[model samples]
Target: MPAATSTAEAAGPTAERAPHTGPIRWIVVGSLLTGLLLAAVLSLVVFAGAPEHVITGSALLGFAAGWALLAVLSAWMTSQPQRWAWVPTAGLAATGLGLLVVAPGDGGLTAAGWVWPPALLTMAVWIGVRIRRALAAGSGRWLLYPVVVVIAASAVGGAVETVGLASDDPGRAMPGEVYDVGSYRLHLNCTGSGGPTVVLFNGLGLTSANWARVVPGVARSARVCAYDRAGQGWSEDAPQPRDGNQAAADLHALLQRAGEEGPYVLVGHSIGGDHAMIYAARYPEQVAGMVLLDATDPYRVGGGPPSAMAVLPSLARLGVGRLPPTSYWSTLPEPAAGQVRMFNANPRGWRNVRDEIATLPALLTQARDLTTLGDMPLVVLTAAGAEDDPARLAGQERMAALSTNSSHRPADAGHGALLDEERGAASSVQAVQDVVQAVRAGTPLL
Candidate 1:
């Protein structure tokens, strides 16, 4: 009887402890889930309303809050406390605080890239080791494992992107001359040698590298120059409010500084067409001819909400943009294709996209200033199926009507394909050549 009693007493403590441990494990799981939800909500709420400079930091702080929650809850409820959670909590809090206090802008965020990735990786590794030792075989470690893995993945991705940024040198990859266009520099790669130089203007988010296929075809007959506008490709960034007028002014300064004489044939694709029109309007005597390749109508309206501008840059800085494959630029030939891929992956480039989109409404409004092109030799090449949209077709016709010597031609290709695909690019090449020929002959287009 005494032996049985002794055994019962020995089992009593473990039996009582089992209930507490089981509930605590479940509570830890619940805490993790709740923390994740809180993190998401806080990030969204902060990003929606916070100032542009503080949005990234606020988002990071939200994540830190989640980790802090885990630390507090585990220590308060569980017998085997996850005190190690404080490490990540403290690290994230410090980083977020630094970003907020410094207000470092894009340059600061870029420099921070070199610091955070390895730091995060080390923190994650330490957390994993602590987790293995602190948590028993089946006590809520599974819940925390996924979070650790995600952190590690993010760290690795950031490292890869940092390395890519370090290696990508625009001067070495692109054959161009960088000229000081006022305060900032612009990259211009001009090829061939002839009268009436064809200055190529890229579409939204495009650079000189995108003109690889079109430039070669046009350079066969006339001098073709393609340039990266401020904050794109190899060019240095300029101030904000980068509207059409600003872009035109920059182009004017760039050409004059580079000694690329005027009375030039302007070849603009997509939004570049709108920029060309603005340029022609601003400097009537300098523009000899124009070729619009699936150009965006200056009158067109609609863009993403303004808040997206704040979120996009932050996401890009975190290496979210590089998660996708570089296959999008595969249609472009080697070297150029590689160059495009590298630039697109850059966080600064994404910020440029944000700034451009933010001012698009103003840009479109400014484009309305161009009322006519008079007798300028102009070709408006519309992509296939563009005519399906009545409004779009009308806009194209209107642009064509601006010039007395203009012709509206339909290319059998998609808008982007007009420059990306060989067949479509050939059609674009022909349009530029036709305008060039007309300009030289001083006659109407055929």
Candidate 2:
């Protein structure tokens, strides 16, 4: 009976040991794998062309903290990995919801920006499930370690790159006179000297710097003025719901405050053409003539305005529109190209541009109701390609009819002809010069 009792006690200890040993083995294996994977990732990040600025002690500390936290979480995941399988999935879902609530400036996630978060979460959940199953099965466990290494490497690379990107600054210089137009400051650039000031208004998202192609030639002929619209270019942000009416009123006030007398020759391009028409109609006495360059039609604004359904409030809440400076400067001259890049990088520029696109339909409707230009000298310059589209040509012809003295000038140029080219000069600049000459001489527009 004593011998039987001794055998039973030994069997009881053996039975309890297997279950206890299994969990400890899993925890030890998971921790070791996690440590090796983290070490490999850290080595990759340190040697993988990390920027000099992000190599500081603080950055290293941050990376260490992040890695430790991730390792702990991953270790926990290996224990009952299937039980918390839904956690990462829930996090991914929450991120998507957050993005929707904080609508970004480009309206949604850009192609480059959308792939990382959800993909990482999916990989993590997959790794967790694989580890749990492998531990339970006690076979094929080593195979899953490679996945951990790969995920860790990728995650580390992305984090490092993100840190580098945030640390770099794209420096931009402001080179125009700033006018406090009540709520915000607008940047204005004016030169030359004479009456009937040539007031240049650019298309959507364009700044005073866009006049680089045309300003030099036009300034040689008359006192010309170009400006950045409110919350655009180097201008300050204003209140919400920015439309053409508010823009026009602001310009009027700007000119007054600047002591620039009118009887002005309003030169407008694209959407600016619509604003010019509105300005002329509203303040006819101040406007001496008008020039519309590849102008949008007031009757039917070619492409309908973008839908206003973009949750604008989310822009402020989410801090969404900050993008890397674009490289569109290749099409423009040196300084102008650089200026364009800087303006594109500005978050406020995107906000204002989106607002303009949203309000364009309403602005077009308002423009259609504007009174005729009467005998005001008007020059409607159509892009050479306009002849290919019968509807567009007809629209151009209708624009010329707004004034009895208006002339329809078809340029052998495409859109954006106003920008000064290094070779042959710009036909758009010449057209504006001709109009200024005609207006100054009090000659017939034809």
Candidate 3:
């Protein structure tokens, strides 16, 4: 009878040890979700102002922490342990530490791209297979599927972006000459032939290709030059903290080296207007006339949230930016359109955007130093909705007041459409033509 009782006790223990079927499964799931939530909160609150690499590394570490939680909690509390979670935990932790220690810049990140994508894909596949084998068929298994999907998708996107980056050869594809502007090279595409050369300055985060619609029209009447700023399009990356002063200095060097002489008719759109104003302020003698197309107000303050800016480069590196369709660039013509899409997808360009935006407050402040353009022919083209915003209209009026010979014309298009759309480009082209004619005739805009 005692031996029978002992056998029954041993069988009871085995029965209790069956796969977790109750509240503990949900607790295990909650652990991973909580880890992810904590990571997100920390990223936005604690690391938002940190450098790009640090922010990226911290995010990886956050993900690793989530996996670590899954490994520990599932093993400790549940009958069906997710021992495979340790694989991702270890991999992510090691990668995060490496990023923190190496602090690799853009080039290093690009090089690492060739390795990490395949490794990530293999790891994700292994994890998925392990989960399928270990987890029972139910809600718990289904709950984990989203995590696997996200990791696998990230791997695929990274692979696609890596291949795209590898194939893009800006030097070979450039339509114009690349001139060494002191520290870095700038791409300058010039067409047509006439004096008081028209130099098109791109808006914030834009490449010369954005001028596809307006350039052809302006080039017909006078020589028009469109060039990429440092760290944009075909231009090589420059040192960071690229303010308006640095931009103006780079342009000056580019023109001097390329022998594209300019008492330039500066055609600037959006933030490009701020850049043009800075250049005119610095070297008033070199500017013959000006056209401000829905230009950004230099006195305006604030921009994108610092937290969003911090994570942008890392997200871009993972190819999140390319998930959106190519339709955004559809308004641009071929070759130019393709070029814009390619460069826009590149992580380097996104980093440049972040850097430029970081210093935009200072750049705008610097532009305010330009109090007057004397009698220079200036045409300020305000976007359609300016009248709806009192402050914006006031800013436009102030810019027009900079030159005694200036004319402020309200356009029928939106801010970007002023140069991107046909009707708006026509308006921009006419403004440029009017300014050119005035410069040549030595008369005011009629």
Candidate 4:
């Protein structure tokens, strides 16, 4: 009886500690979950309403579903916050950091770019403090939990960055003609039947399909061709560097090989203007007229690649090759929307974009010396909304001055005005048709 009583006394303190320890465990679990939820919310903010593109309803739903699943897991693993829940908590933190890097610079605070890092770091510090205090008090050793959490988070992030979600259906080629340009196979789509072939060049990081909205209208008057550059759309990556000169060379080769005879009216958007200019300069006889659509000026694009461009390959390594459900697609119709989705899924697209950005400085430098058009009919279509900047308008004016017979038409549209849902594309089509008419008539183009 004395032995039994002594044993009961020895177990009394441990029994009492159980209630006290339970509350502390719950507190730790709560803190971990709060950190994770905060991280996830910040990520959502970064991806949603990003300045680069509009976040689609489906993407938002996917984000919510991803968060909800994590939340449920966090709740279920409350008892094992240190052992089980920390992995996801660290994952949330890593993903938030990745979002900070991927979020467009123009997004500012709305992107939650400024908020996430500090919040996540603070949480990590807080966790460390708790672990240190617990150890000092001789309560328990909690160091392994935080470390494991961090390692697990990094692993998941690395996996995501490396293996990322590739589309099950990746190879949906655009409806077009594929040409073997020796170095690469370039995809070209054409419509209508007439003289002075209208060739369309997509803006930076965009595919030939970007002109889908405007092609039908232009095809009514002239044969219009929109071709994807190497490593874009249905085209394969090229051994040559992605440069304006290379692009111009590829276009010339494709035209010659495909038996698409020209005297062509070249239409270029954004950076494509540089390539069109190069094409006209290199093969003067082949180009009859030129159309510059909200194009980038060689002088205006700053020296060196953008900081974001440098970070893209790193993000790709982190398994985020593409961010889909872009806002631009919302403006497009059904078949076009579906095509954009497939384009978004292509991992090579980002690699190609990176290469283009890397070579922009060199391309712009090369463009500084492109031969003048002399008297070739030229039309410069400036987006009214984008031309609000005096400097931008000045650049557009300068482009119009490239030819003795040139006209600058201000369209009621934004930078990507051709893709605008309303009359933006129609305005551009009219400009192209007018240029074609002027070139054929040998009349002065205002």
Cα RMSD of all models vs. native, in order, equals: 3.0, 12.1, 2.9, 11.6
Q: Which tens-of-lDDT digit does each residue in 1-446 have in candidate 1?
A: 99999999999999867744665577667667666665556545545534445766776677777778777877776676778778888988888788789888666666778988999899989989998997776777887788889989888888877777777777777697999988888899899988799999888778888888899999999999999889889998886547889999999999999899979998898888888888998998999999999888877794544565556666665577777766675478888788877777677766677677777777777777889889989999999997679999988998899899999999999998888889999999999999999999999999
Clashing pairs in 2: 213-419, 213-420
Ranking by lDDT: 3, 1, 4, 2
Model 1 spans > 4 angstroms off:
1-45, 48-53, 77-80, 105-107, 136-139, 304-313, 316-326
Candidate 1 vs 2: which has more TM-score = 1
Output the TM-score of candidate 4. 0.65
Ten-residue segment with the worst summed lDDT in candidate 4? 49-58
Give the local distance difference test score of model 1: 0.81
State the local distance difference test value for candidate 4.
0.65
Summarize candidate 3's per-residue lDDT along 216-306 as a digit string, tens digits: 8988989999998888888888876578998999999999988999799998999899999999999888999999998899877855446
TM-score for every candidate vs. truth? 0.89, 0.65, 0.93, 0.65
Q: How well does candidate 3 match the true structure, expressed as C-alpha RMSD?
A: 2.9
Write the residue-wise lDDT of candidate 2 on 350-427 in tens digits.
556666776788778777766688877888888778888998899889988988888898877677654534332366
Which candidate model has the greater lDDT, 2 or 3?
Answer: 3
Deviating ranges (above 4 Å) for candidate 4? 1-173, 301-303, 313-330
| lDDT (10s digit) by residue, model 4, range 132-212 | 543223223362356546634533544443333333243454576788988668888888989899999887878877777
Between candidates 1 and 2, the lDDT winner: 1
Best by TM-score: 3
